[model samples]
Target: MITDNTGGLPRYCHPYHGGWDVATIALNIPESRILFICPVTCARNICLNAINGGYKDRVDVLALTEDDIVSGSYEEKTVAAACEILDTVQPRPKAMILYVSCIDAMLGNDHSFQTEEIMSCYPDVTCFVLKMCPITRFSGDLPLVALQHDMYAPLPEEPVPHTDTVGFIGSNIALHPDNELIRILQDAGYRPLHIQACDRYEDYLAIRSAKVNLCLMPFGKTAGELLAERYGAKMIPYFARPDFTSIRTTITAVCNALDIALPDLDAMEAETVRILQECAAYIGDTELVIDSTATLFPDILRKTLTACGFRIRRIYADGVQQKAPDIDAGSIQMPLVRSYEDNENVIAIGMAASSFAGADKTVNMFYDNGEWGHYALRMLAARIRAAYEHPRSAVQVRKEARK
Candidate 1:
């Protein structure tokens, strides 16, 4: 577990030390149009999430099968099939992202060679390879996924002049409310030098010109450290939530770093309090049970729910011991359970695991959408209310119960 300055929850660490292969490839691909070729078994979710996050039209996905794994013929055949698909599709992508699974890594498959062969045959397209290790099975967390993406992205070409530019890094979470940060920065009269999101790599060489680096999330540690050492840029790491108080603190920190006058703290606090109160009213009386195998959102959910006046009855989270101190600080204490037991009155807040566990009512907040996780939190609340007003059908209840 890595602890931040605040002594809260620890940051989650990546499973494999060698770094994530697919994240690197995703970050570096220069072409606007992309294709994600994933190993059939383990990387399906990766491909699906990338596609769902607005990469749908620009990216095509192909899942590799077991026969390919057993025979060692998957590499050539898969590439060829992708090329054929591109040929028939008419408007082919500018580049292809070849994502290897744990099977490929364990089998000692060389994705670089396969990528080169495909690029050579196509001539007009570029290909990059990313190897995804089975982090969950081996080490329990996939923080390296974001890091690998950062690694493969091209470093910024030239440094912006150090006079007034700022860099925003490590904002891969789909629900990251960056608009608030942007508004705060604009109000503070600071012009952003650069803004890098998931898989958006800038040339490190040019990043030093910025006076400071504002790291929105922990994943940007690598880039932030590098910039600090090389370009003398100050790294201001901040954890953002939907609450306005957190936003105000973030703005104050940024202003302090730039030697700008602090904004009106009283007004900011008042506004934040009002917003939180309103949100609480909207979600008051709702009961929620958050379950996460990844452990990325338990604390986040706790804080958000608390702000919105939702009662969290229980949390099914793994990797609590490994999280960074700052992350765990705000985490609420709920009975940790491995499975849903007696969760009749509570609505589940996570992926669709409740359905399999036989929960009467379940809500899936996390779903694979190409590049980001879509927020269905509000939708889940609506459904819960509807279920309270009008119960589910017996047939439908039985169907879900069987799973």
Candidate 2:
């Protein structure tokens, strides 16, 4: 399906950045494999993506046939294919996730009917059925939340709160390994938990023992609710945009949540200031065109960049709900890239930005580089420095490094 307006771009081009969403979370699990049940056409994209990502060995496709559609016998063929997968692979996967594409989601075919039989066939492997339909993006249990809920299901239903342990539930990308937030948590006499560090499934379940849970991403809201409902951990949502005040707010919120005094506020602000200075030095007076499709907080990002000497020509996102007063005052288009007047001079962010404006300097707000909080400033600065020469942006740096 052609999602949204493609801005007169090539029909075959991806609508946005190639994010697997919750499917990418499966990669974090040990000995896990994805059983992608999609059409032959979609399967081709999946196959090529896996190969390009160097994980083709882990992906298997169950392409649907015309006969299967006409006969409506997908349930049987799916079961048979899954059973065949169990018998064929060596050192079998510990978990096999059955992922249905958009077609199946609309068909209203429940694959759970065979869940019991599949488990019975292979008692050793854990199984789950996840919907991979992006069409349900705005609706309840969109792919990201649904997959996260299921992946986290392996953890205990009832978690025990531990005063010393604090957990963060959301995008792993935002939690940098060297995040200073972890240091603050430690100073407040608490250990930090961000799902990335959990190697074992038991470690993930162990989060129930945290005294407080911080929900970072919109998808993480469900995870936070699960932890709170089952484990009774306090779930605090962190949100603010369009200004630098959010950094101070987050720092204060973290302190309050942990029942500790605010950390040296002057010191944290100094760090934020230093990062902003670095960005200003590298990215001067260029008209920047930013898209919200990539970053979680484009409005906040917009205000921050503006304060640091960058001239934003356009913010391609609706800032009304996000409270980006600055963006609302500026040129906030649905993004008419092909009709854009200044593709050459503007610096763009996100794949959507890259698509429309065709900016030579692009900071693709890809998965990993979409940092949150004060640390986000540092990530953006460093990316700008690297991209200053070629204008490839932060995400493009990661992509090139892969080669």
Candidate 3:
């Protein structure tokens, strides 16, 4: 059953996609701490998420009350809070991310004042103003994209000479060193860089020396452009897709940008297809479900898996209608206010689908897990095969996944 868009307000958002939230992503910086200022109501969930992610020690909340917001004293309050944290916190964070939530967006608070005050008080600690404002989502950069951009906005561009470094942006989890992208750069005598691989603030700051920036996700394009404008690095924007054709196109685009010889696409595609066929054969007509959380482009994943003879039972995503005009499987908008029935035989691919289906067999993949090109497709096939061979509780799988 193909569902039509009944656009209005957002109904539900399932919690099974145990990938890192915005706060966790911001904490990716080495020795960095966050001071998230928002209404007390929002702090409950944010604090709990921080505690669960094992970064509670690095997170400080300044819960705003109605009086504090109405009086416009939140700014001063934030300054005091930041000063106290800076003065007492052991070893002192190298960078402080001053995060304000949606209410701050409505208040039209000037963050520069807070940032300036903090820096004045603690000259050694670098201050960055980050917003979690969803109200401005449609106007400028969405919160997540803005966060990605701000994460590296403070790196010094001047006096950092260009090197053989090729920066990979937008993936919280670094691509495996054995990935084809890394192999291509290595073969061309270049070093691949990802923020997740950085062990120190200085290592993360080394992105300023990259000659080229490959943005693996769309949100990273803004950050990539920043690097290009400031550091004169070439920004190549590509998305992670599981299909063979898209993978080839991404590789070709990257090679063209770098003026490097094209890789042997035929051999890579053949190997990936062989893996997919073997996995599909083993699964043997078992119903599979995909969710948007696994791949932003569920339509593409559906086509890729279906071509490999895997039976796609349904796709639960909100925005697949526009891309998938001729939908072949059940298409249900996520976060519906009803309960999902449990199924024993269904093998769910993507955390959202696993949670929604309550299926025993689940593939623990979220946003392709930073995989791109043929490597992504091959790994997906292998994970699916593994899930079939060794079934596990969907809930347990979600818990075990790294945020």
TM-score of each: 0.59, 0.82, 0.91
lDDT of 1 by residue, 1-403 (tens): 4332224534342121111234323543333344454565454544444554444454455666667667777777767766776676656555565655566556766666766777788876666665456443344335453443334343444445675667665543333444444555666665564433333223323355778887655556666776777667898876444344555677678878888777566765565455544544655564655555312456565665566566666555554435634332212223233333433554554333343243444543332110111122333345545544543432355344311
| Cα displacement (Å) at residue 338, model 3 | 4.0
RMSD of each: 8.5, 4.4, 3.2
| Models ranked on TM-score | 3, 2, 1
Which is better, 2 or 3, measured by lDDT? 3
Give all candidates' CA lDDT scores.
0.50, 0.67, 0.81
Model 3, 314-395: lDDT tens digits are 7878766666756643334435554555556778988778877777788877788778887888888888988898888776
Clashing pairs in 3: none
lDDT by residue (157-259, candidate 2, tens digit) is 6546466788877664437655667778877778787656565555555687988887766767787887788888888776424345766787788888777
Evaluate model 1: give its lDDT: 0.50
Which of the numbered candidates is closest to the native, going by highest TM-score? Answer: 3
Error of 2 at 124 (Å): 3.7
Better of 1 and 3 by lDDT: 3
Our model 1 lands, by Cα RMSD against the true structure, at 8.5
CA displacement after TM-score superposition, residue 71 of candidate 2 (Å): 2.8
